[model samples]
Target: MTTELDLGSIRHAPKVLLHDHLDGGLRPDTVLELAERAGYRELPADEPVALADWFRTAAHSGSLERYLQPFAHTVAVMQTAEALHRVAYECVRDLAADAVVYAEVRFAPELHLAAGLTLPQVVEAVLAGFAAGQQDAAAAGTPIVVRTLVTAMRHAARSLDIAELAIDYRDRGVCGFDIAGAEAGHPPTRHLDAFEHIREYNGHSTIHAGEAFGLPSIHEALAFCGADRLGHGVRIVDDITEAADGGQRLGRLAALVRDNRVPLELCPSSNVQTGAVPSFAEHPFDLLARLRFRVTVNTDNRLMSDTSMSREMLRLVETFGYGWADLQRFTINAMKSAFYPFDQRLALIDDVIKPRYAVLIGG
Candidate 1:
């Protein structure tokens, strides 16, 4: 093991998470309180520790319903505008605590329909929550910037409607659009109209591809429907070949990913829990990193996977023998792939991430 990984001062690290799910990251305390207030009795237990363990076990079951159980509890409580706002606020606070300087959290506004809030209302409330959360973090001296990505569920047939909602709110706070949920049969091409509309209206898109599926799913997401970034694209390693000695050839698809700089939001622990990767030791992260795959690390769902940005980084450091420089590359890759205009993205690189790493390296 390359034993130079020290994350003791983790809050000082510049972190970026792009694939976190809003519904999948509810605080256990929030869930218990929300369930009590909402008079919903579906919690596995009222205690936070037990509740968190229940979420991890249930979500890690490798079954569709088990994986989606937490959403029901989270969505049921998110009926009122206030609940939505509180959840959004806490999400940002949690990210800030994890030292995430920039994060793009995505959620399907359509799922928040139980409270009778319109799509735009849901978007607005979440943005208000993010602003509130950032303000609170600033007051606490841990400033962080968070943006929302409006996601449309693939199982639902309202991609076009969601696309319009995202476009309408783009200037407000919706940074990009995504399609997620049960990627087995639902390919990104299913939402071509949504993608095309997003493309026409000057919107950005990142598809949940190559997670529960394989290269064909990724190919379809990128080739058929132009996914600018990929969520959980760990399977692209399938297309790469290891030759005699140290030579390698990225099958056409992996080459496309590398050449185009399509970022892979690789959630190491979550990938193992979800069975996307066999194990952390065998995870393709270091391989992808060494090969320059525009790879970025993330906590796909903090509540479900029981992970923080620090924990994810620590797991990779201890497993992959990653040092500060390796992690610095991951952060830089995420900044490059963030859904922002060139100038703002450059500012994140020049101001936030680079300066922090320089201070760490004494460069």
Candidate 2:
């Protein structure tokens, strides 16, 4: 095995990201420019550096609602089709620079309809942007592939509409469907009809569960709504307990998740900032990884958490002593759990992920 990795080395390592929100990952300067172009006048700060800090501070306000308050500004600037295209293009470009070979970025189309653009227009704009970004990344020699996950806000009632939209564009660029928003009063079961429609079309889904809420939400997402993956399922640790002699006990729900090998899109920094867990040292990621659950590292919101895939992996490496082998395992796990086809996933692991790690580990 190779020695412990550092941030500079980690940044050069190939990565796969599965859980990033579009509205939550914009560059600070891009947000300022978009707001200015759209004549949005309520920005908390005019400068990019201050606006970036404002997002992080607002998200660290110790409440989920407070954490989400900054999105209103980001979404406000992303209403027009041109703005959507630029935001998506910049997302792929940034990820490529970070050495992310594969990613699935998510966004709620319904949220971008305020400026008279139809649902189809929003998806097409983002897809076109992804295409342009992918081409540019290829030309720059950091080639990356990106897919979209059409999301519907759970607090709203447009899940079925979004689910159908996801299927409509599945062959174009959309790869899956998801439900996001406040989870306290809005459970996954409330959108059972949407999940059912996706299942009927044999489509894939990941639900935001067990983050702000408890295990009941997770149960409904998996057993009830049939989610293929869990978004921010960090709270699954609630079902696991340590015994007197350091042995651990897994409750039924935890056992089921582990047994099924259900993918948990765990966002470390975002979880801490949103108060999903107490701190990084007490984060359940290490525990879940040791238990051999299908845990994947992710950046739920890059802007809010001020993170990238490299930063997230660096934090875990420092906290858990993860080496090159551990980093490779996490990358492969994310590739396997991707909504992309199995043949494509296998090719990436064999041709890209493995080869890249082999170089880093000095094979």
| Best model number under TM-score | 2
Q: Clashes per prediction?
A: 0, 0
Clashing pairs in 2: none
Error of 1 at 31 (Å): 0.5
List TM-scores for all candidates, in order.
0.96, 0.98
C-alpha local distance difference test of each model: 0.86, 0.94
Q: In angstroms, what RMSD does candidate 2 have relative to the true structure?
A: 1.1
lDDT of 2 by residue, 184-288 (tens): 999988899999999999999999999989999999999989999999899899999997889999999999999999999999898898889999988999999
lDDT of 2: 0.94
Error of model 2, residue 191, in angstroms: 0.7
What ranges in model 2 sit over 4 Å off? Answer: 1-4
Worst 10 residues of 2 by lDDT: 1-10
CA shift of 141, model 1, Å: 1.9
